[model samples]
Target: MRMRAAILFEQGRPRPYAASRPLQVEEVALEGPGRGEVLIEVAAAGLCHSDLSAIEGIRPRPLPVVIGHEGAGIVRECGQGVTDLRPGDHVVTVFVSSCGTCRYCVRGRPNICPSGFAARAAGTLLSGARRIRRLNGEAVNHGSGLSLFAQYAVVARRAMVRIDPDVPLEDAAIFGCAVMTGAGAVLNTARLEAGEAIAIVGLGGVGMNALFAALAAGAERIVAVDANAEKLGLARQWGATDTFLATEPDCAGKVRAATDGGLDTVIETAGTIRAMELAHAITARGGRTVSAGLPASDAAFSYLHAQLVSDEKSILGSYMGSCVPERDIPRFLGLYRRGRLPVERLKSGFLGLDAINEGFDRLAEGGVLRQILRPNA
Candidate 1:
């Protein structure tokens, strides 16, 4: 089957992506699902900063690939030996598709499944196969197991989680990446106690979700920090106990002072060394600093070893919110349904596939949060 999809042929294109057009909309050949795989008619996909990093060459991926990782859709068909899901089931497309028998999966940490890691790096599905190809028969690499930028996708069964049909697909789209990474950082990685105070550095989709998760978990104080005053304003409206501009003079000192020396936990989601530094600086002694950001592969953040040891502080990295999709996606979605997680507020708007490059321009400009891409629109 030939389908319209976004293909990234090169990385590090000039900014104002509308002009440079890093993701080219092309008609490509898509094969039917193989055994243990599923075919999906994509309903909604979200533009993520991770994708932006790929476009900017911040994190290079396999070339000549159809790139899209965060999405939700309806199942069109299921391959052999697949039993849990069938045609017409609504599901969320997760980037990390774990092999159930992998050591990490057996340990209940599928988020770091080595098989998934190798597959993503090699641009194949969990089965080590590429389901898409250029019209001329050249193979097109899959993006994180789900090339969902197209109208349809063939993915590993582990790449999808059956979802409640009542929830809007556009809203569900954010769940795949932003909600999991952000909220999971707070709830799963940090494990903030109800009375513990926490600060979220960077108010992008992930940071904001950390803030929301803190609130829902009954944190004593939730501090929101961002360079964008508008995002800070949104944080305030959404129930941040305090809002601080990252650019303010002595911002870290102020946050530390205001929270009575420091917060119990600080989550960094900006994917920058500076944000990591700030998050670490504001964490209370004996508290933990969790980094959920995906900075350029070569980028690094440093801290004083002596201070860390003396303070008894710890730093942790969270990938995909340290989530086990089968368990966490539904848990988070339940929170959303109960209105405890108001993820709907994070939806900035929608876009058609042709407007995706412009959408990336807006994302790079920090003008939007999570823009849902409606491929069929």
Candidate 2:
């Protein structure tokens, strides 16, 4: 099959992607779903900071890859050995296509399944096969085992969750990454209880979702912090009880002072060392500081060992919010249906495949949240 897709041939392109154009909109050849795989007509794919990180070479992905990790689509075809799902089913893609027999999957920690991680790093489907090629037969790599930046995607059956047709696809797309990672940070990793005081540092799409989750969980004091004043304002409008500008000096100290020596949990979602530093600083003694951000692969953060020991503060790293996609995606969507999650508000707007580069430019500017790409539209 022929389809329109955005292909990233190179990384670390300078800013103003409208000109650098890290991702080239091109027509590519796609293959049918293999055994144990499913073909999907992509409905909506979200532009995320992690995608930007790839564009900026903050994280290295195989070149000439179709780069999109989060999306929702309608299943078009199911390959051999697939019995549960069929054509016309609405589903959301999962990056980690966990092998059920893997130790992590057996332990209910599918988020860290080594099989899924190895496959993504190698830019192949879970079956270890390359399913896309250029018009000239040049093999192309799959991004996150779900190259959803195109009109259609072929992925392992385990990499998707069937959703109700009533759930809007455009809204459901963000659940693949942002909602799962952010909501899981506080609700799953931190296990924040009702009436507990917590703070979300960095109000991007993920951070904003973390805020919403905290609010729905009955957090007594929800402090929202970000370097952008505009984002801070939006956080207040959403549900944050207190908003702080991270750019301000002594920001952490002020938050601690206001919260009577800091919040019970401070979650860092901004994927920056600066944000991680502040998140640790604002955690109360014996409280936990959680980071769900994806910074550069080699980026390192240092903390005073004595302070950690003396305060008895625990620092946790949460990947994909430590989520088991099958169980948590629907749980959060239920919250959205009940009017609690409200992630639809985070949609900045929509774009076509041609504008994907400029979309990243806008996303890099840090003003926009989740920008949807209607690949077939």
Candidate 3:
């Protein structure tokens, strides 16, 4: 079957948005899944900031790659030996894959699974041939482990986590990326103790999820800081105990005042130098500052050596919130079902595959929460 998809071919160019540059959307011959593989008819995909990064050249990828990592859909085909799942299952895709026997996977750190770079970035599944192709005989690269920007995707069976058939695919799409990153940062990385104080800077999809996770973890006070008032307001609606407009001249100072002795943990989700500086300022002695954001390569924050050493402050760069997706994704979904995660509130824009560029535009505008794509629409 042929599929329509967004293809990134060059750097510094806007993602082929206009009709003149409209993404090539045509049918591609389907290939059978190899061992341990499953074919999914993508129902909904997310326009993640990382996709923006790929377009912006902050993170470069091979040309003509289908660029989406967070997606949910129904299984269409199951390869040989796939006993645990079957067709018609609703599922979400995970970028991190586990060999299961790898040292990291054995240690329960699937995020650091040894083949992570090759497994996700190789532009294809472990089988070594592209599953998506053009009728004209061209091939498309898989942008992460799952090139879900297309109508159909082929991925490792292990990369999928089954969800209740009733939960809307749009709501589940963001879980693969933003929600997992934020919520996992708290539940796995920071693990904010009961009643601990936390401040999350940058309320984008991931930052907002972090705030919600902190609340779930029993943090007594959750102070969320963001320059955008719209997002700050959303943070409040999503269980942020306190919301602070980051534009305040002394916002970090106010954060410190909100939690005497400073915030027990400061989550720097903005991935900006300014946000990191603020995170350092408001972090209490022995507090851990977890950085979930990905800033530009040259970005840096300055601080006195003595301050970090004497205060026992630890700054950690977290990738994918240190989550084991197989385990955590299901748990996150359970939280959503129980009224704890509130996944539905994160939807800012719902668009079709052709509207993918507009989704990024809304996200860049600074107020939108998460922009989702319905490929089959």
The digit string of per-residue lDDT tens for model 2 on 115-221 reads 89999899999999988899999989999999989999999999999999999999999999999999999889999999999999988999999999999899988
Clashing pairs in 3: 2-27, 2-28, 3-27
Off by over 4 Å in 2: none
Each model's lDDT comes to 0.91, 0.93, 0.81
On residues 1-377, what C-alpha lDDT tens digit does candidate 3 reach at each position?
66677776664566434433424455566677888889899998887778777767777677677778998999989998788888999998887766777888889887877675675567776556677776777877878778888888888887778988988999999899898899988888987888888899888889988987887788888888989998877777777878888889998788787778688788988878888988888889988889888887667778888988999999887788998887898899888888888878888877887677666666656768788888888
On the 0 to 100 scale, the lDDT of residue 299 in model 2 is 91
Summed over model 1, clashes come to 0
Q: TM-score of the candidate numbered 3?
A: 0.93
By TM-score, is 1 or 3 better?
1
Best by lDDT: 2
What is the full ranking by TM-score, best candidate first? 2, 1, 3
Query: What lDDT is reached at residue 19 by model 3?
Result: 31
TM-score of every model versus the real structure: 0.99, 0.99, 0.93
Total clashing pairs for each candidate: 0, 0, 3
